[model samples]
Target chain A: MIQLRNALDVFTLVMLIVTIVLLIYTMSVMLMQRGKGKTPTNPKVVTKVRCVQNDYSAERDFSKGDYVGLEIGKCPKCGDTLKVEAIYAVGGPKEKDQPL
Target chain B: MDAGSSSDTWYLILLLMFAISFILNFTDIPQRIQLWRFASYIRRRLIQMDEIESDVRRRLINYLGKLNINSPKDVVDNFMNNYFLIEPVDIEPIDIIKRLSHLINVRDTNVKTYAERYMPGIQKSERYNAIVALEIASAINLVNKVLKHYFKLGLKNNNWVLLMQLALEMPNIIRIVNSYSKALDAFFSGTPIGDGAGPLLVRYLVGNSEPKRIAEDTVYYETLINGRRVYAIKAEGPGANVGKPGEAVEKLVDMLGGNVSRIVTVDAALKLEIEDTGEVAEGVGAAIGDIGPEKIGIERAATKYGIPLDAVVIKMSLEEAINTMTKEVYDGVLKAFERVKNTINSVGEGGSIIVIGVGNTVGVL
Candidate 1:
């Protein structure tokens, strides 16, 4: 009877320890997430434009109304029509600054 | 231990376990504890969802505030709360595609009409963007409202199973809502999304050619590739809209008297978890993701004409599909462009071909 009691006590002690550990782990996770802040992320976007006459191309910060196939203005170097080629967001979900 | 002592120990252990279980069951302690845990978890997720919903609403209002409207908030609320589509009944399943098509068209027209009523004299592209922004907000609002409804219902009725299921599903729900929130920025800023891969490829093929409007919000350009006359079709863009490519293809086939030899489709496809994003893949059949009408129209038109249908797709995740176009997705678009051209050129016996770039052409011309 003493041996059986000892075994049961040991089992219960181990389970209690597991429950405590799990509680700590979950609470820590919640705390860490709270610390991270819930600010909505804004990804860095760029607009790529190429000269019509020459091969001169450049990428600038994305602006409203900039789209592929739209003529922006004359290229500084070539004096030709500069057309927007692409607009895309850079970086990934795991980047240090972008916590998406 | 002695035999009598061993037997007594076993009896005592069993009695203790039974007693504890009886207490737990009779008092509903275990279920209550489980319910509490699940409720706490779901509550946290509900808080996040609330944040996302409010954020989307703010962004929509900010975009609409710039327009010439009396009450931007009211317009957004109307779309968020009132706009909905009742899916066509499928019990009979006869003329279902046509019915669905009509319903979709009506819904789109209503949305556009609402936008026009509020923001009169705005450019069509801007109006389209406003409509898309409103849609994003509506989706987030719907998700938030549905989740809260279930959350409250479960709590009120003490439904532990319901709460547990909700807690389990909250992670994916939050992820989807966050993605929708991110997509708002893409639409408002006029940036192409991953779904725009198809239209971007079509834009590369149809450079400088005059595009004739073929279907509602859809256009086609007659361009020559390797001396083969190719009709490239895509949604008219720089605004968030997936134009009716199916109707366009059907009409174009009718106009040409079924002279189209091959129909090629390019679009973004959802990839497996193990697959790399922006992977260019080729397959057979029409690569369009419509409820029923658009895809059936393409299939029927191809079947009637006896044309070989080829599909080239850029693989991406659902989140990636809606969010702004990434560099990896753009590279995939370029790769798919090459693959599409190769498909067009592979025909030995030459005939006029229709290459349909099938996706939302937001921010792609």
Candidate 2:
């Protein structure tokens, strides 16, 4: 009976350690994720990008469709360089009710 | 090591397990909420199938009725309800439909069932709609089953790690759901998902009327750019579909006697968070999906021929890509069009260049 009790204590200690480690790992992950918006683990970010369009051009009123997003780059009509004139918080933070 | 301390350690173990369970279960609330949304959306679609009139329903009825599927909803519901048990639900159902249709059609070929059963002059569009109804039903079924699975798992809360992992992946899962929703919308509208972008750009660049049907569901036109010929290709648009642009590019390459110096492919790409919609990104290689074989074929052909391949991508949310072409995404079309031209321009006055506007050419003519 004494030996059995000792074995149980050892088992309980091992489980406690495992559980504590798992909890710490989980907490750290959650804290890390809190810093950045929940990006996918695979990320899928294109590092091979030769060119990126960062132009937050003025949010123009389109007669059709709600302004959900902006396609920045070369002007579709003309190949002239297109860039965002000002950031409008269109999609990123503060976009919930931010006016154009 | 004593019995008393062992009992205390057991208590500690129990407390830790309880804490871990609490956190894991708490973290899963967001995913459960998404599942609820998915459930409601799928329920709406299943209900809509009954009332929404005209040919799509009729086609579904006729197609399934012939299959002796008298109560289509029951089959769909059964499939939806029992979907979790359907080992390996990761494969997108719509992708299977095309292959399944081809296989089924081939198997039933000896009897000429399609021609014999349908009324005279039943348009291909009707048949396509029938297939779409089935695909949408399958997609809805998958989501329904998954939503239920998550609901049950949430209730159990036994597998905290599994639940947490799912919680992390919830965004992508929701992203796919949004895309499938758009595809469903496109099906009902009988218009392709933002098809006009690629083809319109192709047309603007080519600046020509005569579009040659070079491959199955693909079209190509040509224009002289700085004393060199540039071949523009896109799926035949203004129809309810994104044509096989990859195959079309291959066909164009072959038709040009394999002397094509450069190939530029343009398509819509899903944007990440903070990446504004309609953003154009220029890069290298193919930028289309759902046509894996075609992408491979093009890549293989390009490699064999030693032709440099460049890609111009119009970035938008998967929601935008699957849904009707929003003004923002459409705006990207012209930008992408311009980018395509620029891509061709940077390639230098080409001996012969192939510019493939790679996307579903659904609306913009």
Candidate 3:
């Protein structure tokens, strides 16, 4: 019974320390990003290219994880005159065009 | 005795944690190295993209300079817009004219607009696009080669989750890159892609140059569907074109004197991971593409004319959509044809219908 109690206590202490370390690491990364004045990386950036003259347009509504490239299309604002070019993934994994 | 035992337990636990930390240090060293390597691969792709952009810009300067201009943002912009388009398949001459007409016009307008401001008497020349298209083709090839190299490196690292993620996403990554490569192939060759399927299918099935030029860059062949006079409208093909079926459909309704019975759109659709490639599905509305410009045209025209629109899709992976058309996809098209015939019959015999094929016609006869 005594040995069991000691093992449980050790586990609890180890877990608490782990939690604290993780919390601190995350906080440091966030602080560093703020210091650099860089927007945190977005994983959802998508880039679509189209000729604007044909009324063909792409929509990148800024969904939380989506990043669309060079924002030109037949949207109400971009009109059908501007063609979108490139997209930036901004530090993401396998950032490529996702078909709409 | 109890106090002594407790103290020993605390000491042992402290040592255990320190030992764990020591072990982690060794494991983390390899992971850290892998992270750096992964970063290196990403950096390489970015550099390639940058190099392509620089080369394009340089080429643009040369082209514009030949026209006696220091700068032309509109022409450059237009060039960039069309330059990025990767046509995987060949496009027809008329279809290419149809597909690129907008970009050509925009650039022409830009040139005219800019000529008024910067370099007067700058003629709108097709030669500029031809030269740039070749450059863009090489650029896409380089970029794709880099992306392939980037994804391949992921396999070397076993313990890194990020690398594993990249490996898993490799198929999709290659899919997009392949799309660009194929688009380049189509653009440089001036051939309409298989995505021009709608137009090509109509042309192929219609089997003649006699297809009536119905709309701007659109055409139709008259046939009977279920004993009803069916007018099949698609973009005119034998070239790279997504013929404006939207406008063609509208024209059909006008020719029929309004109150068309039904509209059936046949095109390729993307299949999910769970679905089989080359599968056939029947649904409502535009099964055309993600962009709604064409869909909107069809839907509005259908709604306005009070017609029931049906979409028959030949299932294909996005990879297949951008890559060359596979036998399976072609077979699916054959199957889709049967469905189209059935759809016409089911909608009602002796009723006028319009069948529109939607997709890029890269390698379909």
TM-score of 2: 0.55
Give the best candidate by TM-score. 1
CA lDDT of B187 in candidate 2?
Answer: 47
**What level of docking quality does candidate 1 show?**
medium
Q: What is the C-alpha lDDT profile of model 1 across B188-263, one tens digit per residue?
A: 8778999999899999898889999999999999988887889999999878889999999999999999988799
Best candidate per DockQ, number?
1
Give per-residue CA lDDT, model 3, range B1-365, as digits (tens).
76677777778979998988887786677676776676566556546555555555555455556556555445455444343443322345445434554554464455345335554554222232233343444455465566556555654554366564654555465446545544443333333333443544454345332578877556688876447767787654333345577767777787788757888888877787667766888889876783434676788788887888888877766645654344455566667777777777776667777888776432222
Measured against the true structure, the TM-scores of the candidates, in listed sequence, are: 0.89, 0.55, 0.52
Give per-residue CA lDDT, model 3, range A41-67, as digits (tens). Answer: 533333334544435545342232111
TM-score of chain A of each: 0.62, 0.38, 0.36
CAPRI verdict (incorrect, acceptable, medium, high) for model 3: incorrect
True contacts kept of 3: 0.00
Better of 1 and 2 by lDDT: 1
Q: lDDT tens string, model 2, B172-272?
A: 66556545644554444344355345655675677534778887657788778777788888766444445667667766777776898788877788787
Model 2 scores what on Cα lDDT?
A: 0.57
* Candidate 2 chain B lDDT trough over 10 residues, lowest sum: B81-90
Q: Model 2's DockQ?
A: 0.04
